[model samples]
Target chain A: GENVGLHLPTLSVQEGDNSIINCAYSNSASDYFIWYKQESGKGPQFIIDIRSNMDKRQGQRVTVLLNKTVKHLSLQIAATQPGDSAVYFCAEKSGAQKLVFGQGTRLTINP
Target chain B: EAGVTQFPSHSVIEKGQTVTLRCDPISGHDNLYWYRRVMGKEIKFLLHFVKESKQDESGMPNNRFLAERTGGTYSTLKVQPAELEDSGVYFCASSRSGQLGQPQHFGDGTRLSIL
Candidate 1:
């Protein structure tokens, strides 16, 4: 059963514009969340992460907001660039190093 | 330090054949992990290794799958008589801190296609 899924499978934004991607998780027991960026033909690169305790965390040009009340997570990119075009994933960490990733959201930057 | 690296970016073979996937983690990383994403499925955990020892292997699909992390420097996953269901992307990751739930660096996955 796919418990983790995004509201949108794809999102497109203009260059220099902001982009937001949302994700919904089914498990209430998940205590940690992380955001990753995956480019074509490459492994996922860690972006930012937020714990259940913190509602928001900021890193570089990206920010991760967590809403534990609704089990929702979102990633926001400022002034999205062409290099930012890739599949974005939200993952939940249960107990150990195991991460359950969402379906994934492909973000495209239109120049 | 160089990040994790996996060999044979892609593979294709008929069913009932054996295949092996390898992963080389970061220089000082002590935690190594294996995960797979089957067709139309999420990335599922395959196993975890901490310093040449298996910590968790609860996600391995069946007995045909064997994973080893000798010397804790690198890891290998072997699939014997692999079935068609084994066709998918296998990803390996590692972390510097051998703690549970740490941020993991990944290797470009190996996409295995079984006919």
Candidate 2:
């Protein structure tokens, strides 16, 4: 079965440090990848996205790197802040419609 | 502009009871979707609606769940005779188009607890 998964369930980073969350997908046919951040008691919020044709994309203080050959995706947050603490999810667009989300990685920031 | 809104932020009911979740998407957005996240599980897609028509419902868990979007505005998902396994956060989202990679704006989910 096709699935998206994360390398770690939880990650802790000190404030001002960079954080990296990794995800792996089994479906190679996926054409789009997205990163969503879900704060406690909130729905997933779009962070950044990348198309299959691109290997990397950068947003405000975040970046998404995709490796189609290894079927892996990663979200990088520069200068982690306490507000950046949340569960980050990596999702892949299946076909042209549905999105398959990874199990999510809980990111904690130490003040 | 206001973002997506969901009613009754939380609900607690006994097993075999019924619960209905409501979602109001962003104004002028024609595409709506339903997704849920069970305890310790990934957020799973429930269905998608293009106006009043159901575009894709392949992710709906079972017949116990019914979703409808009348007049192409607000949508509701009703779970009849809910079971313990149905306890989760139901999230609603919307986008302007049904395009492949359009960003979907999401609302705070409805937390349903089946006792």
Q: Which candidate leads the pack in TM-score?
A: 2
lDDT of each: 0.87, 0.90
TM-score of 1: 0.93
- Runs in model 2 deviating more than 4 A are A1-8
lDDT of 1 by residue, B22-80 (tens): 99998899989999878777667899998899999999999999999888898999999
Reference-based TM-score of each model: 0.93, 0.94
- Locate the minimum summed-lDDT window of 10 residues in model 2 chain A: A1-10
> Would you give me the overall lDDT of model 2?
0.90
lDDT (Cα, tens digit) per residue for candidate 2, span B1-115: 9999999899999999999999999999999999998876788999999999999999999999999999999999999989999988899999998666688889998999899
TM-score attained by chain A of model 1: 0.90
Fnat of candidates, each listed? 0.48, 0.58
